[model samples]
Target: MTWYRRYGRWSLLLSWAPFVGDPLTIVAGTLREPLWSFVAIVAVAKVARYLAVAGATLNLI
Candidate 1:
């Protein structure tokens, strides 16, 4: 909780990352981060991650 209080918003930028992403989201819920803000940020992060992956795959192909 202390870590989240300090780094929560910054960390949300990486909420698209695997492994750590799920825990970060759970902690966000436990800490009661605002629903709209959480969804907006996480949605952006996830979309960015997928776009990056798609770009990389296309480049490799």
Candidate 2:
């Protein structure tokens, strides 16, 4: 929560993956109800952000 308040979504992602545990088992509380969790939003947002950024860069190139 501190990280989320501090660095936003990126911090959340790092917290989820955390280099010492199994991602498949981490859960991160997103898989609870599929309609109410920061995890799903964060993941989707990150992916969308990357795609948007990539598209912009490609257009520029």
Best-fitting candidate, scored by lDDT: 1
Question: Which pairs of residues clash in candidate 1, taking residues 3 or more apart in a chain or in different chains?
Answer: none
Error of 2 at 14 (Å): 17
* lDDT (0 to 1) per candidate: 0.87, 0.48
Candidate 2 lDDT over 1-61, as tens digits, reads 4433455433444433336223432444433423345556567656766776788989952
Quote each prediction's TM-score: 0.88, 0.37
RMSD of each: 1.9, 6.3
Error of 2 at 46 (Å): 0.7
Per residue, candidate 1 scores C-alpha lDDT tens digits across 1-61 of: 7888988766787799889999899888888889999999999999989998998989952
Looking at candidate 2, what is the lDDT of residue 53?
79
